[model samples]
Target: MIIADLHPGLPFFLGALVVLVTPLRYRWIPLLLTPLLGFINLMGWELGTTTELTFLGFTLNPVRVDRLSYLFGILFHIAAFLGILFSLHLKDRMQHIAGLCYAGSAIGAVFAGDLLTLFIFWELLALTSSLLIFARREPRAFRSGTRYLIFQVGSGVLLLAGTIVYFNDSSSLLFEHIGLTSTAGWLIFLAFGIKSAFPLLHNWLTDAYPEATPTGTVFLSAFTTKVAVYALARGFPGTELLIYIGVTMTCFPIFYAVIENDLRRVLAYSMINQIGFMICGIGIGTELAINGAISHAFNDVIFKSLLMMTMGAVLFRTGKINGSDLGGLYKSMPKTAAFCLIGAASISAFPLFSGFVSKSMVMAAALEEGYHWVWIGLLFASAGVFHHAGIKIPFFAFFSHDAGIRVKEAPTNMLFAMGLAALLCIGIGSYPWILYDLLPFPVSYLPFDNTHVIAQLQLLFFSALAFVWLKLSGIYPPELRSINLDFEWVYRKLVPTQFSNLVSAYQRFAEIAHRLWVYSSRRLEVAGRRLHGPDGQLSKTWMTGSMIVIVLLTLSAVLLKNLL
Candidate 1:
């Protein structure tokens, strides 16, 4: 019997169903096994469209196994596994099921060769991932989850509208590069940009990710934005505007990272900065640049998740994650601290680290593309990331003055998750070729050249020195409980408050109008009583002569009309 290649999403989605129905005692088996199954199935895919369907005269390829899609499939599968491992100790079935479904949707989206199929998976991603946020069950989680849902679902709506318009205009459903030369394409691009967390559309990520349950944050940090990156790289590679937009993404987040009080929120800002690098690389679109973009994305999932896992550990242990509220954790949770440092160094792009290999490719590509200024901005961003994510995160949480709070080490499962992530960070860095070999394009770029190493070290060390100087001079911004304003203020604060005021005004107007209506009705009732009620005109007796005269006139008019 010939075995057919399975859809990359099947393991995750089917596993989710099994998880939902299986007895609690045996529920964990599927979580542990699902990603492996997905990975195995992904490896079996044979480099082209594998499954197709025709309905209503539309050709839909449910499985399109190309380099770009395949790469993303691998990443999603791996992420699902790590996410499951990290959450192993939790008893929340909703999280397990929702997270699996979310991963499945992302995997499914990548394999979709037609817009319709991609749209289905795209919306599923939004729905299932949002559940991770709501699973926290806190009121704050609920509110943030709602905002997250609105933005994400809104993106899906745009995607569907754009797809329909594009299909109508072009009479093609093949997913390929469609630059912003037409209405449909621009709509689709904007939809992708929103998911990618382009500058103004970015607040949802920082706002929502920090509010998610710890394990949920790990999953959130991995899939949603990366899918956008994949879509962009897939659908609009070499678009020149992305370079400028990507630069903006890189340069602006550093300021927020420096001042943000919530440590997880700082990581959120840092994520945007890192994604900026990838976007810029994708914009370049040289083989090297595209490889850089894809590899950096891969590297980011591991290190960023590691960082989130550590913060989650701290949150899990002491019930605090704010920099202002946490300190001296290395004293108790040394293993976690070490793992966090590895993640930190990797993110910082230190020599012989995962980030060092992938990020260098992008920087080198930027220079090669004659985007000299863009390269400079990315260079600055590199240092800024280290300043915030690499140094500030570990320093404030682990090495700073003790908060006098002592806690036990993270649970075994959490430690295992961190350890696995840490191993990947080291493994990828030590052997860059493992990741390089998997790049969607052939690799010619080298990250370990003497010039590259020296230049990166100088930039990173100088940035570290600035941090030290600022700290010694007492000029570094201290973590504050009061929130700083961001683009989200327009939605999270200003819009809601404005809407509340508008509603109050409307309610007051309704009250006044209601009172006027009541008064008018009373006056009309009084008039009726005076004129036509029991004691009024119609009820009173009239003189017989007057009544007869009236009746005679009425009869005369009627007789005249009939004669005419």
Candidate 2:
């Protein structure tokens, strides 16, 4: 009977439609309560629960509960609640609707027992989340939103194509481990890779996140890619290719984040770096590795949201987000600055932070699994991430030279949301087992061993020292007013420019062809007129004598031919 009830995530989807009719004054009730109800609904289901239906001649499992999906369901509900709480001051009904639907789609996707069910939610996630970007109501935002939609929708298309191939090949649609040896598997893997923001497939994130409205960025940071991560952890764990791809993801983004001027864009790049750690863990595929990967994902969504909220608060209060334009806001927004430092510490994997607990497991797993080079690369990436994201973000945005900008602190609701996130960061860091207990596999490893702690601390200390040395010696990259080109340049600039040139070239060729055609046509017309006109030689009276001579010559020629 309980199986007959609506899906846990359906409440949020239904809440989205309800948002339209709800009065503006009372909107927060549903915004806050929807996720709560969804969370409660998820709690009611037992592990191993199954719900089936017949759709289009196939028995479809729309809901299948297990540890993995349950963990993500809880994580998503928490993220949704925090995001809604942070946006309490917003009056934009469309954003509220979009955020709810987007969160619901992610929740639905993780619970989907069939690829077809997942595909439906996958496309919905793209459509709903793009609305947040478009909510900015600016031309630049619109363009960025369009580009974002292309990547997200393109990802869904790949999933659909891959699903069709996979189903045809296997005659089954269960969402389960699908190793990458078949055409369908590879196609699906690529689909997940695009959503995971893997390497060159990543520009959409940096292009879109900063362009979204402040609160919208917080929502944007939570769901889409993490869902892809879930898909990877579920379907392609232990794939060797992921290790190389993940390490590359970790290293390359550090360069971009270091030079990026927009604080939010830096965070966007940082996000890729964080995801790299998880991907690498999933690649390792030990019990410790999978636990580490998903747990990191859990911590990342929270801490990253905290960081985004701080930046959003800055933008909300001061109308500026570029590092070049912001500085010494600690004077007014001290609480925000404090919260930001916690976020920085958490993301940087400081010994007493959330990242430290989960990130170490992945590294330990790598070492145990004999991926020496991978472990080394991950170590380097850890140092690099702290250098840019950890040091650069807080230092420039809050504690750098005074830009002479004074602004009020973020609103109370924003602070409350951020404060809650900060507490979770500390709580999880201090007692990681609380989170560890919820992992799909039993977590038996301890993060606070003396040897590991000392090493991590040394890594952090030296990284800080190097940052200081660079800054004091004037070698550090300065915050500046400029645009840095990334891979998106290929499409945003190169492709478009070349396309314009092609159009111009075609126009020129068409002009020349038209001119030649007109000239030749006129010449033929003139010749026709001359030959047919009354004044022309062929049309004169002499034609009668010429005709008689021509007939005699023809007859003489015919007789000569016959004699021969």
Top TM-score prediction, candidate number: 2
lDDT of each: 0.91, 0.93
Candidate 1 lDDT by residue in tens digits, 446-504: 78888998999999999999999999999998888867899999987799999999999
Candidate 1 lDDT for residue 75: 80
Separately for all candidates shown, the number of backbone clashes (residues 3 or more apart, or on different chains) is: 0, 0
Off by over 4 Å in 2: 1-4, 541-544, 554-564
Off by over 4 Å in 1: 1-4, 507-564
Model 2 score (lDDT): 0.93
For model 2, residues 1-564, the per-residue Cα lDDT tens digits are 452367977989888888889999998888888998888788888999989988998778898889999899999999998899999999999999999999999999999999999999999999999999999999999999999999999999999999999999999999899989999999899999999999999999999999999999998999998999999999999999998999899899999899999999999999999999999999989999999999999999999999999999999999999999999999989999999999999999998899999999999999999999999999999999899889999999999999888888999999999999999999999999889999999989989999889999999999999999999999998998897888899999999999999999999999999999999999998887788677765576766888899999999999999999
Tell me, what's the RMSD of every candidate? 4.8, 1.7
- Of candidate 2, the 10-residue stretch with the lowest lDDT total is 1-10
Task: Specify the highest-lDDT model's number.
Answer: 2
- Which residue window of length 10 is worst by lDDT in model 1? 1-10
